[model samples]
Target: MRGRKTDGDDERLPVISIVGLGPMGVRIGHALQAVKTRYTLLGHDVDAARVRAALGAGAVDRGTWSLAEAAAEADLLFLCEPVDAVCATLAQVAPHVRPGTLITDTAPLKAPVLAAAAQWVSEGVAFIGGHPIVRWPTDGDARPDADARTPAVGDGGGSVAAPPAPDAGSAAAVARSPA
Candidate 1:
């Protein structure tokens, strides 16, 4: 979140942290890399192998096994873990997350996760419930392959899409520019 101020706006790019390096997390990392986003991607996973694989594939700028380290400076934290693990992971990272940090999840179900995240919202964190729906028809396999060239979320090709942010007035719409 460190950057020069420009016209009353912070020009610094956000530091994005992905908590789980599973298939979904990996896909998200790849998309970010493909787009050449200005943000720095910080990837983490309890499984050491997944962290190594994500780092080797260049999906993240860096990888870490420590949840606290990853969440410490993240401007945006994506909880890409499974539904059951989302709340637990949030609790573990809450202590390290800075105030005003935006946290979202890729979990399919939002009710339970959002309910569990109420504490974070009360603590001055922005909690946005996000679910990126994959539009590409899978070949009966729910997971994406390692080298798949899937489109980034919110792209017009219908590859990925996220739900509306909690604060609609503050949410910025994402549009893909001509390549």
Candidate 2:
């Protein structure tokens, strides 16, 4: 794995690549930025604007379009796209990942991801299926159907926003400022 030095700390920063810079991707990026992990975040997406938005929002350290370029030497990789896209992306990314590279995805279903991952696990690329597992409660659940607002899907492991004071059309804003 490649690493970059941080000022005052001799240890090298691990590289974390985030593929698919959509809402989930940006949310992942936002949540990552909220923490103080000493790792470089590299983001990529088929949509250039989303990548640009992630970069501009301080969610990622850098952005790229090439799957191989983004996967090379990455210590950790997060596939934050839809299920089908995640499967397709895994194939393209698996080849470039070095042994010991930990790869995971935000797909709702584990079967597909695990099935797709089977091809590369033997090669030392570890794949884990990521999911929320539990949802405590949402704005919709708390109130009557007439008043409830549907819960917005998030990056799997995080608190969901409550009712009222919603961010217009962007869930990314909600991600930037977590509950």
Candidate 3:
């Protein structure tokens, strides 16, 4: 009798790319990798060394120089860039984002970010503002549990989900600063 083949044998995982290889960015990439095996965490930065470091550390699977390249393949794009960098990044990558893509950011502040997101909305991209209630030290070697408890999403009469959990060893336990 001939051997039977199964569809599972050739299945491939969807690639999820993360732009910006900063501290938080690396952590976001790793966090997703921790949960799913099919993830392709694409890391990028101005500095080639940072991209190398993230890949070497297993935080990201590979590196891409262009934001548009990564955005095209990402099912969900997580932006871990600084507050000031996000606006320009979005403008540059807006044309490449496919329709119905879910984009999120972890900027420190809220007001300015919300304004920036409005522009993307005009361009047909959905942006959600999330401030991970945590921050890691300059030198920490741990990651948060993939299933750690995170904040609930509130419908701001808008389309963005709540922020995700912070890095494992983040110094500021939550993304919010101590009062």
Taking every candidate in turn, the Cα RMSD to the unseen true structure, in Å, is 5.5, 11.7, 10.4
How many residue pairs clash (N, CA or C atoms closer than 3 angstroms) in each of the candidate models, in the order given?
A: 0, 0, 9
In candidate 2, list every pair of residues with a backbone clash. none
Q: If scored against the real structure, what TM-score would every candidate get?
A: 0.76, 0.71, 0.68
True-vs-predicted CA distance for residue 149, candidate 3, Å: 19
lDDT of 2 by residue, 56-82 (tens): 777788899888988884788888889
lDDT of 1 by residue, 1-179 (tens): 53223345668666889989877787788888888747788899998888888888777888888898888868888899887799888788878888878888888887778777875444567777677755443555444344534644544332222333455434543444444
* Candidate 1 wrongly placed segments (more than 4 Å): 2-13, 136-145, 152-179
Q: What's the ranking of the predictions by lDDT, best on top?
A: 1, 2, 3
Q: Is candidate 1 or candidate 2 better by lDDT?
A: 1
**Local accuracy of candidate 3 as per-residue lDDT tens digits, 6-100:** 24775444556667776667666665656755445677777777778778767777787877787776656777788878767777777777765
- Indicate the residue-level lDDT of 27 in model 3: 66
Model 2's number of clashes is 0
Q: Whose TM-score is greatest here?
A: 1
lDDT-best of 1 and 3: 1
